[model samples]
Target: MSRLERTMNRYRSLRCSGIADELQELVAHAEANAVSYLDFAEQLAEREQQVRERKRLAGNRKRAQLPPGKQLEDFDYRHQTTITKRQVHALLDFGFIDNRQNLVFIGPPGVGKTHLAVGIADKALDAGYKVLFRNALELVEELELAEMKGELKKKIAQLTRFDLLVIDELGYLPMSRQARYTLFQLVHAFYEYRSLILTTNKDFTDWGEFFHHDNVAVPIIDRVIHHSSIYMLGGESYRLREKTTAG
Candidate 1:
């Protein structure tokens, strides 16, 4: 008998996890000239390979780290009357495209802005693009830290490395003069070089207020909007629907 057969016999006597019983039955069959150790070993190896494949896929699923409550399949394209389903599908496809153009999703709060943004970002990841998602406020904080440590340039370079940088909220906070300057510098660096997805409640005309003044805002807006596809999303608050339904 081979080492595998010896091990199986020992395990059979110990009766571990019922594999022993199963092995015993197989061994009895083998002894009766019915089963072969090579076949059993091949089956065991195949099962192990399947287990490893499952673990690999699980890790990929988790690392993708998509939005908590949104998925491509879950998007209600049927109710989105203004935008055709074909256009929405095209937008999703754009996320995977390699031209590296900018995309903007403008809409009011709770209108699935983040949902579509995240959904696209998830697609980008699958297409082998590196993506970074953060709110404008959080990005400001990171810039602040970088400035304090005298590593602002390095941090800006890091941000530029991502294939897609998603800024979740725009115009939510009135940025200070310094933050405004830093944001402009960041935008200027990526001018026509990388893709960005910006979600904002305010339209282009009102984006100046986000800088707390017009002077700094106009240039950034001009640079961002120059070569971008803009999508105006209009819909009732999806969150409100959940609340009403729950009530």
Candidate 2:
């Protein structure tokens, strides 16, 4: 490469800042004196600005990933036959929304509980909180797998870093004694410090049936509700609508 071009290539790679305008002056002087270097400095400054702009966009994108979807706005609270507007507002006002208390939504199958929980979680994420959504059965299985690999504790630590955790379908699967204990450990560690959004089709009275031990179920309920919001739901199955329409 020519001297001027070679110098410019090296300068661009260095990405030096605050040298562009100075390079213009130098280029002008160099042109008059038949010497080169100023143009190379200007090219480096331009490259630096380009790199910084790209980094800024990448950072914004990473932050945007925290909020998964816009389903919150379409939750259709008006269509939910069980929860009243007042109750919904109260939940938003509860310590759960402001102070990050855990929230448990208990109801029979087909209630709009998961929709409401996801709605609230979306709002939290929009407020710049980190969130993770998983089914209780899936998370329990994953935790068990991690335990077999001797990494359960590390996995729990990673889970705690999220500001909001949404665990749906808590009673879908019968948890073994070990699964119950591992889940208890996860919930206990997150107690009071982070927000947990749980949607369960089983009532608290039946929790022992899933856990398979009264001792574990009782204390888990006690700790979970100690500083939590309970939304007891009652309604027909939302799935019924589709069935009726199809008929």
Candidate 3:
């Protein structure tokens, strides 16, 4: 084999495939520019690093499961006047995640609660923080199933691995006893360790009714609100508005 082919094979074997793939282009550029040996090596390292960073971010985004097309720019502050552009933009700094705080959005359906939560989550993913998004009912059901399988603790551990957890559509439906208990366990696991972004339809007073028991709901609410920023998104439903306009 040629020396260049042998060198490319070596790079691939060392898991420097990014450098290996660009080897020909990089060599041509180096010869054209009469670049020093040190400069060429630095260029190769930079290319590899960039490629790896892109791959890592892509993987994190996939694992986050953020809803497609929900970004900060897509959020309509015009319809939902309760929250301002400045307030939402401030979250991009990611201090809340760094401080291990939570964000709670409370409002009726279709007021862009999920959109806001998802927008912030997408930003978090872009900022290199691990994030996971799930519907509240679905997450509770999953926890319940994990409990049934005697893997609740394991599941909780896996969940707590993310830097931020986005639980959408809380209080849209009532939770069963087992579901409430498991949900509490999962929330408790995340308390003070990682941040959470929650979108709920129910207010604080109505949480007891939503959970089916005041006793079980209180502790969960306490943990969720502690060190959290609560945003009340009030206005008519965006979906309803659109439907009416279409009609």
Candidate 4:
């Protein structure tokens, strides 16, 4: 009912949580330091902005679905010398998302395909891009179920909304006919609308074997490769190397 209580209540109602938290402490500091009115206002605004920025980054990270601890800096680039340092550095610029281009990483398992995909997508996430990451098999399974449930179109629409889509571990299993069809539809829809990243363990020549349906696989490859850069990686498994050293 008092003046100060009424003022604090108004700040809470306006959702100025950072200002509410720091008001009393900052006011004391301002008085002690003989701060001007403009300086005090700037401090209050800065505090609120910092709080909002932190929340934005956390939300972006969650939306990106990047596996934990897979940053480019943490990746052992020296081991995967096949990928040029300049090429790896260029990806973090996140320009491909703006240009609506795609990237493909083709290599054997344990050569850091997934790590590179996640790391590059992480940079986009930090820049406030909406990203979705899913294992290739998981995406195919979901699409298959959607088709069976007569929700294929709607599911593809939902996926196309993201700024970037990272599908990891392609060609690791034989895709079903329905899933292949669904995936083709997705690529066609995303063409020139959003960027995408695909990491596969098989060569382009062998991609048709995984789809098991030439008509479907070839189109997927054509659409994906039409506006994409492919990175080839070759090296011993970093995991195996680390284990050998630790032993």
Task: Please report, as a residue range, the 10-residue window in candidate 3 with the lowest summed lDDT.
Answer: 208-217
lDDT, each prediction: 0.75, 0.73, 0.93, 0.87
* lDDT for model 2: 0.73
What digit string (tens of lDDT, one per residue) describes model 2 on residues 36-98? 466555554565676676665555445434334435556556557566766665665435745
Q: For model 3, how does the per-residue alpha-carbon lDDT over 1-247 read when each residue is reduced to its tens digit? A: 9988899999999999999999989999999999999999999999999999999999999999988888888888889999999999988999999999999999999899999999999988889999999998789888988999999999999999999999999898888888889988988998999999999999988998888774879999999999999999899999999999999
- Supply candidate 2's per-residue lDDT for 90: 63
Off by over 4 Å in 3: none
Best by TM-score: 3
In order of appearance, the predictions have TM-scores of 0.72, 0.71, 0.98, 0.88
Task: Give the candidates in order of TM-score, highest first.
Answer: 3, 4, 1, 2
lDDT per residue as tens, model 4, 39-98: 999998998888888888898777777788888888877789989778988877778888
C-alpha RMSD for every candidate: 7.3, 7.7, 0.9, 2.3
Better of 3 and 4 by lDDT: 3
